[model samples]
Target chain A: MLSESETMSRFFESWRRSIFDPDIPFRRKALDVFRHQVSHVPIYARFCDTLGIDLSAESDDDNTTGSDDDNTTGSDIDNTTGSDIDPTTGSGINPPSGPKKNPAISQYSDAAIPLMPIQVFRDLLIRPDYLTIPEAVFRSSGTSGSRQSTHEIADLTLYEESCLRGFGRFYDPEQFAVRAWLPGYSDNPNSSLVAMIDTLIRHDRSGLSRFLPLDQPMHESDFDDIREQNKRIMLFGAAFGLMDLVDSGAPALPSGSVVVETGGMKTRRREIPKQELHHRLAEGFAIPRDAVHSEYGMAEMCSQAWNNGSGWFACPPWLKITIRDPQYPMELLSPGKEGLIGVADLANVHSLSFILTQDRGVMRQDGTFQVLGRWDHAELRGCNFLMES
Target chain B: MMQSDGQITRICKAVDAWLGNESGLLEQARERTISDGLFTLHDVGHMLEQVARTVTCEAITAWVEKSRDSYAVQNSGRKDSAVYDKNVLCLHAGNLPMIGLQDIIATLLSGARYHGKLSARDPWLLDGLLRLLQKQLPENVITWSTNLDDFEELRADRILFAGSEASVEPVTSRLWELRAAGKAARFLNRTARFSIAWLSGKDVEELRNKTSGAESPGLLNDLVEAVMRYEGRGCRSVAVVVAPCELSDVAGTLIPALQDYVKKYPFLHSIKPEKSYWASYLETMDRDFFESGPIILTGDTDLMGKEDVVCWISGDAMTVQQIFEKAGPKVQSIYTVENPLPLYTEALSRAQKPPIDWKPDGVDVLRWLSG
Candidate 1:
C-alpha cells in the first residue's frame, strides 16, 4: 500500500520511463495511463463517470489495483450537471450532452474505453489539476478569432520529450537541417506544430535551421545556406503551405532533401487528396515520391505519429491509435475497417490519455493506421436558418 | 405577433399561384440543381416530387391554422403587433433541397419581412417559389441575397438555422466569431440527425399475412421505401431498423426487399462517396453484411452514414429506447407500422413525404415566427 501522493508519483515515473520503454505494449500502457488519468484529471474522470466506466474489480495496474476506489488520487471530482463549459463562448457545449453514456456497461475494454471528444479541448481547458497553472498552452491553428483548441501543457518537458523521441524514431536531428514552413502557425506562439518544429530546430545543432516566411515566396536561395552546410534539408510545411511554396516557383531543394507535409488546409483553399498532394510536392521539390513523408500530431496530445512515405502513421510506443465505430462510437472497429479515429496518447499523462477525433481513419492488420481525411458529415444549416459550415 | 387574416390569405394565394402557373418547372429546378452539382437528377427529382405533394396551398394554409391553434403561440398573442415591422432572416442550404421552404412560408405568414441569405447550393426552386411571394407582398417586404457575401450585413430580428453545433464550432466557429449574438431566440441550432425504422413481432406477422399472396407486402414495402429514398441522406431516411424481439423473419423479408429495390434502382441518385467506402470497409472486416449489390446491408450497426449502411438491431423495446435515447438529439424521426407503446414517430411510407406543416426538429416554424 502507498500514500496517494506516492502512488501518483509512481504512475508519473512509469510514464516518464515509457518515453524510453522499447517493449511497452499499447494495451498495457493504455490501461495503466487510463487509471492514472481517471483519478487525477477531473475532466477525464467526469467523462468516465458520464460513460459509467467503473474500474475492474480483479485488476493489477502497477501501484493501483483491485477496486476503482484505489485508482482515486484523493481529489474531489464534482460531477458537472450538464457538460464541461465552453471556454470560448460563455454558453455553448462541445458535443452537447447526449443521454448519459451507454447504461448497463460497467467495465470497458481497452478499445471500448470512452474517448473524450476532441472538441472538449475547444470547450474546456484540460489540465491535470484545476488549481495549478499550466507551464505552457498549445493551440490549434484556425481562422483568426475562431474557437481554436487549447491544450494546457502541465509539463513542457513532456511535450519536448515526445517531440524529440517521435522525431528520433525516423532520423537523427543532428544530421538534417530542420527548416519548417508553417504559415499561419508562425503567428500564434501557442501552436504545438510550431513548437514541435522549433524543438527539432534546436536539436539540429548545426544552427542553420529556420522557418520560411508566412504567405511569402520561398526561392532556391532560402535553402542555399543549409545546402552549403553539407546537411540534408528536412523541410516541414502543411499541405497547403507547401503547395503555396511550390506554386510560388520555389526551385527544387538540394538533392537527398526530405519533404514532410504536416496536414491542414486553410478554409478558402480547395482541399487536395493526401497522395496527390504528396505526388505534387515530390514533383515540385524534385524529390522521389517516397521521400515526401507526413507527420500527424495535434495540440490536444503530447505524442505525434509519423509515416515515412508508407501512408500509414505508426504511433510511438507512448501512443495508441484505435479505429472506432462511427455510429456506435463506444465500439471499436477491427483492422482494415474505416471509422472514426481514437487516440490514446500516454504522453498526455498530465491531461487526458483518450481522445475521440473527428478525422476519419482506418487501422491496418499490422497496427499502423491511415487517416482518410475528415468524415463527410452532412452540414446542418440550423433553422433552415441554421447556416453551419 | 399574431398574423392578420389578410396576411395569411395573401401568402396562401401566392403559393397556389406559384403551383398553378409553374409548368414542367419542377424538372427545370431539378436540372439547375443537378447542373450545379448539388444533387443528382434523381435526387433532385425525388425532392421535387415531395415538394409538389407537400408544399401545396392547402398544406401551407392548414399548417398556419394548426400553428394558430397550437399552444406555442396565443391566437391574439401580440399586443405590440405592428404590420410587417419585424424582419425574419431565413438562412438555408445543407442536406435537403428547399429545406428552408417551410421557414419562408412561415415568415411571410407571420407578417414579418422575409430576409433570405440562401447558400450557393440553393436550387432555383426556392427562388421560383419566392418570386411569386415577392409579387404578392409589399415592396421591400421580401428581400434576399443568393450569395453569403452579405451575411454580416444582413439584419433580421428572427433567424432560422439547421446545421450541427459542432460544425460551426469547428468550421462555422469562424463565421460565428465574425458575428455577434443577437436577441433571444434569434436562431434554432439544428444538428445532424438520422431516422430509424422500429419494428416488432406484430409488424413481422402483419407483413407475413399481408404479403402471403400480395405482390407488395404492407409494412415491409413501406420500410423499404422509407429506407431507399434519398439514398439514406434525408433526415427522415430510415438508417436503423429496431425490433423489440428477435428480428427473425422481419430481417428475412426486410433484407431481401431492400436488395430487390436496389436491384431495380441501382444507380445512386445522390452520390456521397463515403457510402461506397463504408461498404468496402464492412466487407473487409468480415462483418455480418448481405448482398453488396450497390446497397450495403449489414447486421452490425457500428458504422453508419458512410454508404447508407442500414443496421438491423434486435432488443427489448426498453433497450431500443435506450439506444435512441442516448442519441436522443440525433434521432430525427422513427417509422413503424404497429405502435406497441405507439413507439413510432411517423408512418413508414410517409417518411420521405413528410407533412407540409411538419415541424423540423419538432420546432413549429409558424409558432416560432409568432414569437
Candidate 2:
C-alpha cells in the first residue's frame, strides 16, 4: 500500500494524465449529467424535445455503445476503447465517414457535452436531494435584491488533493508560507476565502498563517500588522476588495509574498484596469505585480482553474477548457479568436463539467487562457439562463 | 414640544381630521386591493408605516404604543374586546427605518384583532408577514416546500390545465348554469386574445424607481394587457396608457407602442378580448373628458373647482380612479381617488397610528358592500 503522500501524488498524476488523455473522465461525467437531466429534470427533457433530440431515445445501451439505435446519434461519435465490439460492424466503433457523418453528427450530438441552462441549474440546487454527495456547499452573496446561488463543493479531501496536485506542479509547497488577506464575515456560512484558509491549514506545513485586515471600514493598522509580521503572504480575495486595502494606505509586504485572488469583480465594487489593480497591489504588498493570481470557478462545478502568477489561467490535466464562437455555439474557435469559455472538469462526477460559461475568453496555443469579462447579452442556447430566469 | 394649549388642540385637530376623514378615504382607496385578496397584515403594516412616517413621528414603535393605547381606551367598556399583545401581534414592517409604528396601526384598523401588549421585538414578524402575504397573493407568491407533507399539499393544486377548444366547453358549462340560475359565482376561464402596450422602452428605467409615482410608465399598459390576455380580451378590453387622453391621435399612438411591449412580454398574446374591451371603454371615456385638457371626470365639473379634480401624477404616470355619484341603496361599493391624493410615502406613515374609526374612500366601498 502506498503512503499518504504517495497516494496523493498518484491522484495528482492521474488528474494530470486525464487532462491530456482526451478528457475522457470529463466527457463521461458530462454524459452522466446529461442523462440525469433527460430522465429526471422535466424542463430539460422538454427543451431537448424541442431541440429535436429525443432524450427518451438516449438509452442505457447508448451509454456503453455511444450510439443510439437510430442513425440519430450522429457520425463523429468516438467509441470508448474498452467497450464491447458491435457484431455487425466487426470493427471497433470509428468516426462515421464523409457527408452522412458531417451533417448527422454535427446536427445531433454536440462535439462537447452541453451545459444545463441556468434556470434548470438553479432548480436542481433547490432540490433536497441535489448535491447529496456530502460536498460542502458555498453560496454567492447574491446581487442585491436577488436570490443567492448555491455552489456545491467537492469533498474537502478531494479539493485539498486537487489543489495541492495542481499547485504543486508549478510551485514548491515547502518553500512558500501561505498567508491570506481574505475578507472575514461574521454571519456568512460559506465564505470562499474562509474555505481557502481551511484548505491551506490542512496542507501547509508552515505554522505561519496571516489574514490581512481588509474588512470594511479597514484601517492602515491592519496592513501594519502584516508588514511587521514579515512573512511571505499568499493574499487571496476579490480583486476590488484587495485593491481597496492598497488604496487605504496598506503597506507593502516582502518581495516573496504572492497574491492570489479568485472570482471576477465585474458586478461588485468599482473595477479598476487589470494592470492598474496589479500595480497597486504590487506597490502595497511590495511584491512583484506578477505574483498576484486570479482563479475561476462556478457554483455548479467542483474544480477551480488558476492563473499562474501570470495573467493567464491554466487548467489542470483532468480539466479541459474550450473557447467557442459566441454567436455560433457549435463552432469551436481557434486560438486567438475571442468567444465564450466552456470548461469540462473531470472531477465533477456529481454535477456537470461541460459548462458554457457566460465569460468571454481567448484560447492560446499553449492551452493557457485569459478571461475578458462576461458576455454583454444572454446567450440563447444554454440552460444557464433558464436557471436564472 | 407644545408651547400652548392652542397648539396641542391644533395638532389634535389635525390628527382627528385625518382620523375622521382621511383614514376612511384611504381605506376606500384600497377597496380593489382588499377585494383582490392581495392585501395582508404586512401590507396594512406597510401602510401604517407610511402614515407614521408622514406624521414625522420620532419612531414607529412610539406610534404603535400610542395606537395600542387608543385601541385599549376605545374598547375598555367592551366585554369581548380582542386583546393586543406586542408579542402576539405579528409586525410586518420591512427594513426601512421609522415605519414599524404605522404598520401596527394599519393592522389594528384593518380589523386584525390583537392580543397582548404590542412589541416589535418578535422574531416571528418577518415569517408571519411572509406567510400572510403568501396566503393573500398565492398567484404572485412562488412557493417551494421541502417538507414532504407540504409538497404533497401543493401538488394537489398543481394540476396543469392546458387550454384547448375541447376543454373550454366543459369548464364553462357549470359557470353558465349558475349564471342562468341567477346565482352569484366566480369561475376560472381561459382565452387567447391579448396585446401588451407600453409608453416606450425607455420608460422601463423610470418605472423601476421607487420614488417615481408615474403609474409605473409602461406597467399600466402591461397590466391592462395582462388582464386582457386573462380572458381573450382585445385592445379595447384594457387600455394601458402613459397618459389618459381623448385625442384620436393619442389613442392611435398607443397601437404602435404595443409592438415594443409584445417583444418583452410574449405572454400578452394570452389576454382575453372581453376584458380588453371593458378596459378600453373605460379608458376611452377618460380620454374623451381629459383630451381637451387635464380634467377630473368624478363629480360635476361645475360644482368642483379645478383644484378639486386634482391630477396627482407620480413620476409622470396618471393614477386610475373609479367614480360613483348616485346615492343609492346599492350593494356594490363606490370607489374614488381622493383630492390631494396621498403620496405612497405619506400614506405608509399614517398607517402606523392607533386604530381609529376614520374610513378612507376605498373602505367606504367595502362598508357599502358589507351593508
Number of clashing pairs per prediction, in order: 22, 89
Question: Interface root mean square deviation of every model, in Å?
Answer: 10.3, 22.4
CA lDDT, every model vs. true structure:
0.66, 0.40
Q: Write the per-residue lDDT of candidate 1 for residues B113-227, one digit (tens) a residue.
A: 7777666665466766677777778653566666544556344567666665333343244335434223332666555456777777787676655431139756767877777
Quote the TM-score that chain A achieves in each candidate: 0.79, 0.68
lDDT of 1 at B348: 78
DockQ of 1: 0.07
TM-score winner among the candidates? 1
- Write down the C-alpha DockQ for each prediction: 0.07, 0.01
RMSD of 1: 19.4
Candidate 1, CAPRI quality class derived from DockQ: incorrect
Give TM-scores of the second chain, every candidate: 0.83, 0.25
Chain B alone, candidate 1, TM-score of 0.83
